[model samples]
Target: MIQVVLLGSGNVATHLYQAFQKTSEVEVIQVFTRNQSLDFPSTIQVHSYNQLIPADVYIISVTDLAIAEVSKSIPFENQLVVHTSGTSALDVLDTKNRRGVFYPLQTFSKVKKVDFSEIPLCLETEFEEDYAIIEKMALSISKVVQSVSSDQRKALHVAAVFSCNFVNHLYQIGSEICEENNIPFSILFPLIKETAAKIETLTPIEAQTGPAIRRDEKTISKHLDFLQDKNQKEIYQLLTQSIQNVKKL
Candidate 1:
């Protein structure tokens, strides 16, 4: 079994620990956390930052800003330490230990149960030998494992923000608009699902539809005028222009 020590008690760490527990090929030796919000199996050990025990791999699933500080706190040197960050570079981990990144390309929530087999695991390590070890651990739970560099991972992270976070915010705006019109936001559920489903087979450019792509200025103007919120109007205009520009290119 691949013995592992987990740091941080956030969504990612908690989900990872849960997944690892279900898999027979990997074992979470200990979890180091300042907050005790998560409930782990009775067999697993939980320690504070300074009381970490020796393990084959130390997975730091902390925030990007805390990664360096957390890595420096580890009492051991030359041990394999990896962080679960998409934006931070691999070098952010203290050089006193072998550094790597084990970024899962999905937004995690404590309440949501993640299917490890579907989630893409992005792995990078300083030493080639370490890659094999990390890969083995990642593959134990996830089927999609790829070697992604720090720069490439950062780009992927930005794209994810655009596709996931930003798109979700747009949904919130749409819901607000629906609410103002006394329309049930649930009425748009099918449309939202179809929009997402289309991208599965069609390129986003090919899946593009509606007034913005068609350059229906009258309809676009109507939407802008209908939106009483200045911010919503601005966003509509900006997105319409952006769509038109992309078509031109």
Candidate 2:
């Protein structure tokens, strides 16, 4: 069995711990966290950062800013250490230990139950030998495993922010507009799902439709005029212009 000591008690850390618990080939030796009230299996031992125990692998699932600080605090040397970050480079970990990244390319929420097997695991290692160990752990929980370099991972992270984070923000804006008109946001759910489903078989450009793509000046102007909030109006104009620009290419 692969032994692991997981650091942090946030969404990623908690999800990893729960996923690892269900895998027969992995054992979480201990979990280190600053939040004493964080919930976990009663069978598992939880400790603070200063009381970290020895394990075959130490997984740092802390915030991006805290990654370096947390990894540097680990007293061990030359041991396999990995962080769950998308944008941060693998070298952010102290050179005292073997460094790597175990980035799961999916949004995680504490209240949401995630299907580990469906999440894509992006792996990177400073040393070649460490890759297999991390890959094995990844495969134990997930079916989709990929080897991503630091540079490539950074690029992927930027794309993800645009695709996932930005798109979600747009959804929030849509909901806000719907609420303002006494329209149930649920009315748009089917269109939203259908639009997303179309991308499964068609490129985003091919899937593109509506007034923005068609460059219907009248419709675009109507939308801008309807939006009272300056921020919303600005976003709508910017995105509409972006769509027109893409079509021009």
Candidate 3:
């Protein structure tokens, strides 16, 4: 079994711990957190860096800013240490130990249980030998594992923000508009699902619709006039122009 130590109490850490439990090939031997955590069993929870045990891999799944700090605190050297950050470079980890990245390309929420097999695991390592170890661990839980470089990971993270985070914010805005107009937000569920489903078979440019794509100025003006929120109006105008600009390409 591949012994593992997870060093964070956040969503990624929690979900990773759960996923590892279901696989017989990997075992999360211990978890190190800054505070006493309710997520993992207390028996394996260590709050001090000195209490960390020897493991095949140590995953620092903390905030990007704290990754270096946590890595430096580890009392050992020359062991494999990786971080679960999509945007952070592999060098962010302290050089005392072997450095690597095990970024899962998905938005994690504590409330939502994700299928580990479906999530893409982006792996990178400073040493070529370390890649096989990381890949073996990744393949234990996920089918989609790829060796992504730092530059490629950065670009992938930005694209994910645009596709997932920004789109979710627009859904919130749509929900608020529906609520204010006394319409059921659930009514948009089918449309939202269909919009997402279209991209599976059609490129976004080919699937594009709405007044902005058609250059219907009257409809665009009607939307801008209907929206009372200044921020919403600005966002609508900006997105409308952005759509037209893309169409010109």
On TM-score, the candidate that comes out on top is 3
- Evaluate model 1: give its lDDT: 0.90
Q: What are the lDDT figures for the candidates, one per model?
A: 0.90, 0.91, 0.95
Enumerate residue pairs that collide in model 2: none
lDDT of 2 by residue, 1-249 (tens): 999998888999999988998899899988887756355754454665667778889999989999999899997888999999999999999999999999999999999999999999999998889999999999999999999999999999999999999999999999999999999999999999999999999999999998998878999999889999999999998999889888642
* Candidate No. with top lDDT: 3
lDDT for 39 in candidate 3 is 86
The sequence of per-residue lDDT tens digits that candidate 1 reaches over residues 201-241 is 99999999999888888998888778889998888888888
Candidate 2 lDDT:
0.91
* TM-score for each model: 0.96, 0.96, 0.98
* Model 3 deviation from native, Cα RMSD in Å: 1.0
Q: Is candidate 1 or candidate 3 better by TM-score?
A: 3
